[model samples]
Target: MLHVLFFCLCLRQVNGEFVDDEVKSVMEGDSVTLNSGLTEVIDEDLALWRFGAENTLIAVINVIVGSVTVYDDVLDERFRDRLKLDHQTGSLTITNISTLHTGEYQLQTNSVRKSFSVSVYASLSTPKISRDCSSTSSSSSSCSLLCSAVNVGHVTLSWYKGNSLLSSISVSDLSISLSLPLEVEYQDKNTYSCVINNPIRNRTTHLNNTQLCPPCPECGHCCDVTEAVIRLVISALVGVATVVVLAYDIRPRKDE
Candidate 1:
C-alpha cells in the first residue's frame, strides 16, 4: 500500500505536453461535457477516457467492435451512474457534479491526447438581509444587518461598503444556511451591500445607510447625538447668514 501511495505521489511530479489542459466550470448537482473533437471512429482506432492526475481509466469505446464499457469497478462512487460516453465524438458527460468531482480528466486515442481541469461550484442562493434591532446603543442607533444563505459550497459570503469590500468569509461544501453580520451607525451615509458568490455567479443586495438607518430618532429608536447636533448647528448658521444678507439689502433702501 505504501509503495502504491509513493508511486501516485511521484506521478504528480511529472508534467508533459501530452496534457492538453482545458478548464470547465459546473455548478454542484449539474452536468458537464468533455469533448474529444473526433467525428469518426474506425475499427483500428483505440480511444480511452480517464480521470485524475493518475489517469484512472474511466470509459472505453471501440466502434470497430461496436462496444462501449464504463469501467465502473475502477471508478469512485461519485462517478457511478454519472458518466456517459459519445461513441461518435468520444465526449464524456459527468452528471450531478459535486466538489468531489473537481479535478483533472484525460482523453487518449491512438492519434491524439487531451486533458481537462474541471471545477465544480456550489450554487449560492439569493441572500436575505434582515434588520437586527437589539444592537441599538444610546450614543447611536446602529443598524445591524444580517445576511444569510443556504446549501452553499466552495463559495464566499461578504459585506461591501459600496465597491469596497468590508468583511468576507468562505467555506467548502456547507449544506446548511450561514450568515454574516454588518453594523453601521445611524449617521453613516454610505451605501452598503451584501453578497454571496462563487467563481461562476454572485447574488448581491444593496442598502442605503441613511434611508435604512436614518439619523433622526423615532419610536424610541437610538440616534447619534453628535451627528444630530452638528446638523442643527449647520442649519442655524445658514439661517443667520440669510437674515444678515436681507438686513444689509433692506438697510440700503434709502439709496433706492
Candidate 2:
C-alpha cells in the first residue's frame, strides 16, 4: 500500500510539473507557434526545445521565479539558428521552415520529456508564360512563327499551327523562345498558335497573320520581298510579346 501511494505521488509530480503545447502542419519557409500554457515554471528547472534527426539541442530557456523560459530558433541552414521558444506564452516559433526540418520534436523540462511532431509542406504556384508570339509570311521562301516565354528556363516547348502539332523544342535559357520552320506557304490568311505546358502550368497563344501575301503570279521566281521579310520579323516579335503579357496580366485577377 505504501509503494502504490508513492508511485501515485511520483506520477502526479511528473504530469503536473510540466505540460506540452504542440504545433502542427507548418509550411516550408514559414513559422510555427507552440504554446505551453499554465505549465509550472520553476527557477530550479530549465525549459528546452530540441529538434532534428540526430536530436541536436536547439535552444534552452531558463525558468526563473516560477516564470516560463522563452526561446527562438529559425528553421534555416539545416535547422541551425532556426528554433525558438517564448516562455511568456510558451510558444515555440520556428522560422524559414524547410522539409529537412520536419520531424518529431522532444521538449524537455527539468528532465521530463514530452514528444510532439511537425510536418512541413511546400507551397508552390503554377508557372506562367510571360512572353508573346508572332507569325508572318515571307515572299522569299517560307512562313515562320516566333514563340517565347519570359523568365522560363530549361523546359519543353511545343508549337501548333491550327490544331496541327508542329514541333517540340527543349529550351535551356532563362527566357524561352523558339522559331518554327514553316513548310507551307499560303497566299491568303493563316491561323497559327503555340502551347506551352509544364508540370506547374499550361499556356496557349493564338497568332494571326499581319498581312495577306498572294502566291507569285505566272511562274515568277519569287517576290524580292525584302520589305516583306522585315515586316514578317517585326510581326512575329510583336505577337510573342503580346501573348506573354496577356497571359501574365489576366492570370492574377482570376485567382482572387
Candidate 3:
C-alpha cells in the first residue's frame, strides 16, 4: 500500500508537467506530424498518444508485447484512417487535416512526455478593392474606397500604400468576412494594395485607381459645358417672352 501511494504521487507529478511545449500551425487539407523525439522505442518501452480536452486515446505502441494500436474508430471516427504512427520514433502524423482536428495533442511514454497545441487554418481568399461611392461626398477631396474578404477566418486584412501600412484588421472567428476602408486623393498617383494573410500564406490584390475610382470630369470640361447649355436655353426663352409683351402693349393701347 505504501508503494502504491508513492507511485500515484509520482504519476501526478509527471502529469503536472504536461504543458504545451510547442505550437504548430497548418493550412487546411495539409498534413502535420507531431514528433515524439524518440530515436527508437526500446523493447520495454510503451508510447501512447491522446487528443483533445477529453484526453481520448488515439494511438499506442508497446514494443514488449509487439503491438501497435490506433483507436481511430473512437471519438465518432473524426480521425478515421488519417493517423500514422512512426514505429521507430513513435511520432504521430495526421494526413489531410482539417479544422475539425484542431486541438491539443499529448504524447506519453516511459522516458518523455510532451504536449503540442495545433491550429488549423483555412486557405486565405484574395482581397477585393472597390470604390465606396456612397461614402464619397461632393465636398470631400479624397476618394473613399473599401477592401474586403469573404469566407475567411484567422487572418489579417490590411491596406498598404507603397510598402507602408495604412490600416489593418484581424479576425479570430471562423468563416467570416472582413472589410477595411481607405481614403486617397482622386488626383494622387500612388501605388496601393490590399493583402489578406494567415500565418502560413498570404494573397494580395493591387488597387487600380483608373478602374475603380477614375478622375472626375475636369471643372472646365463636361460639367461646365452642361451648365452653359442650360443657361443659354433659359435666356432665349426669356427674350422671346419680352418681345411679345411689348407688341401686345402697343396694339392694345389704341383700343383702350
Maximum-lDDT candidate: 3
What TM-score does each of the candidates earn?
0.64, 0.37, 0.73
- Root-mean-square deviation per candidate: 16.3, 22.0, 10.4
C-alpha lDDT (0 to 100) for residue 57 of candidate 2: 65
- Tens digit of per-residue lDDT, candidate 1, span 1-256: 0000011111222245444567777677877888786776663366888888788988998866789889756644668888888877788888777778889888888765777788777667888777655555545566667778888777789999889989998877665877888877767778888898877778987875546753323434334666788899999999999999999999899678
User: Distance (Å) between predicted and true CA of 66, model 3?
Assistant: 1.9
Pairs with backbone N, CA or C atoms under 3 Å apart (clashes), candidate 3:
none
Maximum-TM-score candidate? 3
Ranking the candidates on TM-score from highest down gives 3, 1, 2
How many clashes does the backbone of model 3 have?
0
Model 1 regions more than 4 Å off: 1-17, 72-76, 132-139, 172-178, 187-191, 208-256
Candidate 2 lDDT for residue 212:
25
Which one wins by lDDT: 2 or 3? Answer: 3
User: What C-alpha lDDT do the candidate models reach, one value each?
Assistant: 0.74, 0.54, 0.82
Candidate 2 residue lDDT tens string, 132-199: 12444445455443455554544566666678888777655445344334334544356766666543
In model 2, the Cα lDDT at residue 122 comes to 46
Clashing pairs in 1: none
